[model samples]
Target chain A: MRAVVVDDASPVPSFEQVRSQVAAMIRSGELSPGEHLPPVRQLAADLGLAKNTVAKAYAALESEGLVVGDRRRGTLVLAASASPETDRVRRVEMAERAAVRYLAEVGHLGFPAVDAIDVVRRVASAD
Target chain B: MLGDWLSIVVLGGLSSLIFVSGLGPFTDRMLDRWCLRYDVAVDQHGREWLRTQLRRARAWRWCGFAVGTVVSALPMYANVIDRNRAADFATPANRFAPWLLAAAGSVVGELLSRRPPGGRRAAHLATRHWRDYCSSRWVAVVGWSVPVSVAFAVQATQSRDLGWRWSWLGPAVALCGSAAVTVGLRHLVNRPGAPDGLDRLVDDALRADSAHHLVGASVALAGLGTSHAALALDLGWLGLLVGMGQWLAIAAWWYVARQETWNVARVRWSRS
Candidate 1:
């Protein structure tokens, strides 16, 4: 079974860990559109976190348009879009967020902006 | 002086043994062996989670033990105090009430103590239903039989009137109580797996073990209740024999509980 892990030891915040993993799953299409996410309370209880932590994660996912919440049914994965233009728009938005995070991480290692961008191309071709 | 001391020592030792013997098989010695098996908790997270569970289980045993001992003491004292006690005092309720009440106490303790917090963990994407934990064969046999037997007992009990003005109330209470337990078992089975990061086998084993016991407790209660209701109501030969069969089934439960915990381990769950 696929899982979303929240490691207390991780530098990333617990709610961010949940949001990032769930978002990755949705983008990869591992969680299909219309699939229901586990309820906030159940997921929070399972992870032994306060309910608000999971609720915040869910809210973040909802704002990113990866999932939507319903009063009766619970959170469900949403289709990125049917049109190619909207899909590219959502894709670029995600790429912009990733590029910022990547740059911040590499900058800590004393890499200049040009070198960091060069490394992304090198890593992409190597993969 | 030495002879007097020796006699006192022997008598005191005997009394202690007799008291401890009544606590049944789930003793301190056996509990150590059980906890040792869970040294299977390789990581600190798993160990902490299991430690809480073991603590709750042992803690509740004390609660139940105290409840049973106190309840059982009442009838035991009454029997001893009055050697010439009338037949009324020797009734089934009088004879068996202490142990029955003790069992009730233990059960209540288990409910009070069982759920431990689910700590840091990964969530399995799939949701588990109550049906996943048990076997279909079990459902067909014991599942169908529990309600059927309870109903039979309720019907057989009708032949004789309890001393109460509303005799039907006794059986009604039994039915409602059984229903509540059945519902509780459903919720427990359906509840999410342990909060700790456990391997699939350990997780399934724990779940199956709990579900097995809940069913066992219910069947035992129903059988014992039926036996008492029929016999206490003085529902003659046919009803009494039906009651006897239920009694025998409960006796089987004692064997299964002891033997299965050690022997069944993993495969029993694999089949289900």
Candidate 2:
């Protein structure tokens, strides 16, 4: 029962926000194989976003092989694929969300994108 | 003829009672009874918010009840005024139409209460299922028995008591009603629930508690339809006995609801 938040003020598009959060949930095994993703219309209404935005996010997930959609059974997470491509997609999405959150928080402090990335590089090497 | 007319008058008077009850005193009692069970009252604001919400819901439900009463009463009224067409008007088709309409109208009214509050901040990620709100095994038994009751009515039709036998309306309403209730309840259970920012557990609890009324409405409506079926079949004492099964459904619901309320209260107060 993990949740997704749509931060209205974030620079990321709503669709990406939805896609990334749901993607993260699947990758972390929060939403399992055969588990239903919330109905697109319901998720859209709750997030106060357009239904198309949610639908587009779902489309992105289906394209990534993270979920499958059926008109009758609704959108569901698919079993994890061992394909390297699927793994890369999940990795990139997880990093993108972390980056977005970091950038959003740092952007408020008047830091440039270059400075934020530099901080990330410095912190990674230090670790 | 005199006894028949007297019976019509008595029936008409019951319709009026149904009307006055629709004005909302009874509905309010129903609302309070079911809601108070899950009134978590995390604070003064949450409590007051729920109160205002319920008041608004009560207003909408009253309108629905009024609409149902008027609809059901129209046929009964026509039956009286056009006494010459009494046989046609008093047929089981028209007789049970009111109950069916009234049940549907009430379900519509329940839907109206589902407007999400303005500026909700977060939503539950969990997709609610019927099992989440109502999973008692006993409830399953009562729900399954509704079909048996309907089936009994069908079996009763084999008798050549043409004057007192059942019509298709009773079974039709029960079947169609089961479908309608299924769709209606599924929507209610899964619909965007309590305002997003409320404590998730509290929000879930409030929604679950509200759903109990819907569960009750469903069972009560099925019971009414089944009761009507038994009565329509004109099984004499046997029909009356079967018809009383509705009360059993209601009683089972009531006992379960009360038990749930006490269980939650005891757990919450004791632990927290």
For DockQ, the strongest prediction is: 1
Q: What's chain A's TM-score in each predicted model?
A: 0.63, 0.63
- Candidate 1 chain B worst ten-residue window by lDDT: B164-173
Q: List TM-scores of chain B, every candidate.
A: 0.59, 0.68
lDDT of 2 by residue, B214-272 (tens): 55545655665666666666566786686677567557546543445423432432222
lDDT of 1 by residue, A1-127 (tens): 4678877778899999999999988888888887888777667655667789989999999888888777687788877552576557656756786798899999999999899999989999999
Number of colliding residue pairs in model 2: 0
Error of 2 at B27 (Å): 13
lDDT of each: 0.56, 0.61
**Predicted model with the maximum lDDT:** 2
Under CAPRI classification, how is model 2 graded?
incorrect
